[model samples]
Target chain A: MKYKSQKVAYWFFAFSMLLLILQIIYGFIMAFAHLGYDNLHPVIAFNTARAVHTNLLVVWLLSGFMGAAYYIIPEEAEYELVNVKLAYIQLITLALVGVTAVIGYHFNYWEGRKFLEIPRPLDWLVVANVLTFLGIILTTLFKGKKRTTTSLVLTMGLVFAALLYLPGMIWFDNQTMDSFFRWWVVHLWVEGVWELIMGGILAFLLIKITGVDREVIEKWLYVIVGLTFISGILGTGHHYYYIGVGKVWLIVGGIFSALEPLAFLAMALFAIAMYRKGEKKHPNKIALSWTLGTAIVSFVGAGLLGLAHTLPQVNMYTHGTLVTAMHGHLAFWGAYGMIVLAFISYSLPNLTGRKLYDSNRGVLAFWLSNIGMLGMTVAFGVAGVAQVYLERRVGLEFGDVQKEIQVHFLILIICATMFTTGIGLFIAEFIRYGQPTDEALIAATDHDA
Target chain B: MLSKSQAKVFFLGGTMVTFVIFLGLSWNSLSKEVPKRTHEENLTAQVVAGKHIWEKNNCMGCHTILGEGAYYAPELTKVYERRGEAYIKVALMTKTPWQPRGRQMVAYGMSDKDASDVVAFLKWIGEIDLNGFPPKPDLKK
Candidate 1:
């Protein structure tokens, strides 16, 4: 909102929304497929559906992060983006590459790596796209008048994420070596660098909504970053446990990953503490709701739930079961997903010059999505525990266990419907706000003046 | 509360320590643990080719190897011991796509050479020392 160039983020966010819708559709496909409705099995097999679902989730989240950077970096650095046109070009290329990769999965033209199915050729495109993005962000930051801690942390996360992608691209003939390095990308990004991104965004939101001093907010950002590095870097060992790796990872992974929740807990506490200390006079209650909601919910979903199965003993039984799906759903939803929603909620009105944050629709969207996702988590949890008992403990055949668990998909479908409805409402609000306009820019500039 | 400068120092120092530890752990795994059991000598040309085939086919999208993939399919880590390479080849050749008895396996229409290589790759993985993961469940009722 501070600069005309910031308007470019709107397209990125819009693109992300489209992909999210596609992701949810694939989610439904898988859910129904789980219910024995393999009607689409031949064309859109479960594996293909899964690849699209997960890959779409990742791409949309990355797009959201890119959008956040575009919006935040300008304001934080006190300047317009150096080249707005290049930013637009980057967004288009990113979308094109993402679409190509997702489509390729249908033809089995991808590596089998979880969360990293993009074929090598497309991977190179991704690298180029990200380089363009970082070039714009970094050039703007360095060229601007000032660079804040929040901006620095966010930039560091982006840089590390870009670097981490290399390990996954490296071709290895040894399966163990390949799996070991793949986690360097997947585990490190989500648990390590992405936390920095979340913290930076959370700090920016809290400072804005709570009317807190930048000093106070940035102080907590440091603590969160500290806790993140202390626990998260070593936390990569968690995924190393059964991957034909050495045993030291068990102790290293278990102990460190158990501590990963502390960072999230610190995040929750940081947000609440800031809110309590503020004057409580920000008129944008919807944005405040999402900011606070992200904090508390991420703690539960990512922190507590992550801790539940992080230990080696528990993980032995639940490594790849629905238990993982249980943790994965809530963790991603609460942490990155909610934070992106918070950013969108906070920035949309300012960009569009609309003051629609107090509507019933906004509140409904917040509660419906949170409640629906929580229900889905519970559904996945129950099904997962039952699965562990029946399949792993009872030694029932995998197919029988899956059949036994089909009933849970009913609950999953119902809850997912609610979640999707909430998302639909959120997107509706985004559309209602319309596009960013010159008048909004004038208003923002006048308000600042 | 720590001052800004103090907090910055603490953050930087902590980050360095964390990095050092991570490096240490990774080196241990690479130098000692991986070498101890990976048995580089046993990794034949066929095994290496099989690993590529496994990745090319996106097998890990469904079947887990060493408990690290989608759980919809059975774990392939021990498949060599559970079902021999011959059975695996036939399963691939038939392209049944689904088993009436258990979870379905998609027919990838893998060539015989590819199938044999994939089996070799799984066998190589199964031979590595996992340091006691997927520990034996107490089945004695």
Candidate 2:
């Protein structure tokens, strides 16, 4: 128990949070440059900023999640991490690869797809980390005294996510084929394997916090897993609809993606039910609020907006617009962003063994982020819809329409700044004063049983 | 967290309701939209040959006709409207490659015939009469 989980994990989580901070800052800058139909600064163009926003978001979240996994998996398995050396290596490898990939993107050495940013060689490095992490998890799972179903599901989700990523990165002579495969990575994981991770991790965390009966939570877990894959595979169809695919795809994507939200909804309901039915109360009220809020927003950001564009008719208007960005910013930030943050909050105290981590600051960050996200989503969505009306229906020049939407884009910039300040506050709390008082620790412990 | 009994019923109801709504929406989409291929209807053998070249080259990789390909390149659905067949053919064959920002297709060094083929292919896709096929170009990108 003494070997270092919390302190070590905080560093990695902090590392990733730093990347996320960069992502939001760059995202705001880009939004501003595009604001008011004129470039605020042409030097850091919209395209360049977008590249930074997306890459930072992905890498940052992964780093935080990896840190959390090392701590949680060991405890759940009731053993030390199977390979501490390999975990360090994994972190080093990830850091090196991420840096190189960002540089590569800046220099335009990309494969030209949005999500599949790292070119092949660095991609190989990423794959290596994934496999090593998977190996560690597997060894621990098989060797452990406890083999919880939740841990198994989470490990498998990680494995499958890596599996999906591999095919998408392969080089193809055929551009269309390459593009098709590229989306398989981005869409498949977010809509597919990653959701399994979300479900399993959320389920495990809920149990620790709420002391919900394991049997009841386990049953709900199965439903979540089932719906995740069922709806997820079909969710890929939504991207397919516009990609030189036939009408059959539209039908398939629309139906399946529509079904995808149900899994999200299930997760929300399950979390709420557990909270309501809890015997022991959660000690970390702020952590619990974040977890709960994260779940609800995941349903809204990933589910509702997702459903809006799954319809071919609606996608006709919204497909490439800021509407898509509107959905992506919220969905990614809400679902993965909050899930990983919850992990950081939950594991930080235990790892650091520092009592008196202020839970209120985390709560403040949560609400601020949620508010900023809502503002961006609403403002951009309205702009996108108005754009569709002007250019598509009323026949205005697309350039003119771009100018028109710049005003709303500015609002997005302001909201993003607010969100960034909130994240900074959370990070400060995380670093300087995260170890909670003894009373809180005892409560967290009592709540677990 | 539902009572073991209560959870099962709630889960079942949620799943069934979601499935039904999705199915209903999909069915409605398929029934409502019908596509007419009138644009590809009147095509010359040369244009058809050009289309074949396009298919063989997988031009969609770099050039998106109607918001469908890799964004690394530009949208080509409006290409004919922007530059017509002659300019398209000449540009494709003529190596006016801007070294700093070279295109993905430029390296393939397409022949005049190949350029014509891609032009034809772009024209063919651009002419689809589906009500919502070509979405408005997204500025957010």
Candidate 2's residue-wise lDDT over A201-222, tens digit each? 7887898888887777877887
Q: Which candidate tops lDDT?
A: 1
As a TM-score, model 1 comes out at 0.97
Q: Give the count of colliding residue pairs in each prediction.
A: 0, 13
Clashing pairs in 1: none
Question: Per-candidate DockQ versus the true complex?
Answer: 0.62, 0.12
Where model 2 places Cα greater than 4 Å from the true spot, the runs are A1-7, A36-43, A357-360, A434-449, B1-76, B82-132, B135-141
lDDT on C-alpha atoms for all candidate structures: 0.86, 0.68
TM-score of chain A of each: 0.98, 0.94
Model 2, residue A18: what's the lDDT? 78
What tens-digit string does per-residue lDDT give for candidate 1 at B28-120? 887777766778778999998987778777777767787887766777777787788898888776766766454456776778888888788
Give the DockQ-based CAPRI class for model 2.
incorrect
lDDT of 1 by residue, A51-105 (tens): 9999999999999999999999999998999999999999999999998988888
Q: How well is candidate 2 docked (DockQ)?
A: 0.12
